[model samples]
Target: MDMEGEERIAAPRAVVWQALNDADILRQCIPGCQSLEWTSPTELAAAVKLKIGPVSASFSGAVTLSDVVAPESYTITGEGKGGIAGFAKGGAQVTLLDEGPETLLRYTAQAQVGGKLAQLGSRLIGSSSQKLATQFFADFNKAVVARAEQSVQS
Candidate 1:
């Protein structure tokens, strides 16, 4: 499956870039993220719980950041296993565009599933992925803007 979208954050590119690189902010923003630990500067270990249709599973994965250009763009790739549920692997290219007072965050991603997850039908899995990605960015945007507001006030 393939997915792509853009989000406009009410913060400058610098602030948004900081948020994107911060693991704590990502853990808070990602849906069902149990934990995310930085194993290296550009590598992270992740645990995520996902419920698609009637199946619920916890996935353990590794995420790597590559092709990085600070405060601009990077490519991220991850693969996870969910025991009996199956496995998923995907990669995304993320770009941050400076839009004056706001930042335009765009991503293009491709994913593949195998075993039980692949058995759940393409539509169901695709929609679930789309929903999760949407929620993550929305929550992230809110968090980033809220911190920006707090800084301005203080």
Candidate 2:
């Protein structure tokens, strides 16, 4: 499956980039994120639980960021296994555009799944992926905006 989206955050590009890389911030924004830990400056270990259709499972994954151009863009790649439920692997290109006081984030991702999940068919998988992606970006934008507001108040 392929996914793409854009989000406008009411914060500077640098601030947005920092938030995206912060484990604490991501934990708040990502749905069902049990943990997000940085093993290295460019790598993160994460645990996520998800329910897709009738299947629910916990996934342990590692995400690596490469081709990084600070406050601008990076490539993220990761893979996760859900035992019998399935396994998923994907990569995404994320870009941040400075829009004066705000930042515009653009991302495109491609993912593949194996085992029982793939048997659910492409339509269901595609829609589920879209929904999850949408929710993630929405939550992330909200978190970033809230932080920006708090900064202004302080």
Candidate 3:
């Protein structure tokens, strides 16, 4: 499956970039994320529980950041195993653009699933993936704005 979208966050590019790299903020923003910890400057380990249609499973994976250009753009790739429920792998090219007092974040993503997840049908998997991605970005936008506000207050 493939997906792309953009969001305008109410913070500067620098602040938005900081939030994007913060594991704690990402853990809170990602739907069903149980844990997200950085293993290296450009690598992270994560576990997420998700349910699509009637199937549910916990996926553990390694996320890697590459083609990085500091606070401007990067490519994020990940692969997760979910026991019998199957496996999922995907990658996204993320870009951040300055928009006056805010930041415009854009992403292009591609994903694939195998085993039971693939058995669920493409329509189901695609919709579920879209929903998850939408939720993640919305939550991330809110978190970044709130964090920016908190920092100003401090």
Which candidate should be chosen as best, given TM-score against the real structure? Answer: 3
Residues 1-154 of candidate 3: C-alpha lDDT, one tens digit per residue: 9999999999999999999899999999989999999999999999999999999999999999999998999999999999999999999999999999999999999989998999999999999999999999999999999999999999
Candidate 1 worst ten-residue window by lDDT = 128-137
- Model 1, 32: alpha-carbon shift in Å? 0.5
**Residue range with the least summed lDDT across 10 consecutive positions in model 3:** 128-137
Across 1-154, the per-residue lDDT of candidate 1 in tens digits comes to 8999999999999999999899999999989999999999999999999888888889999999999999999998999999999998988899999988999999998888888999999999899888988898899999999989988999
- In order, candidate lDDTs are 0.93, 0.89, 0.96
In candidate 3 the C-alpha lDDT for residue 110 amounts to 93
RMSD over all Cα atoms, model 3: 0.5
Count of residue pairs whose backbone atoms collide, per candidate: 0, 0, 0
Comparing 1 with 3 on TM-score, the higher-scoring candidate is 3
lDDT of 2 at 134: 84
TM-score of each: 0.97, 0.96, 0.99
Q: Quote the positional error of residue 59 for candidate 2 in Å.
A: 0.7
**lDDT per residue (tens digit) for residues 1-154 in model 2:** 8999999889998789989888999888777889999999999998989888888888898989999999899998889898998997888899999888999999998888888888889898889888877898899999999888888899
Residue 133 lDDT in candidate 2: 78
Sort order, lDDT high to low: 3, 1, 2
Q: Which regions in candidate 2 have their CA more than 4 angstroms from the true location?
A: none
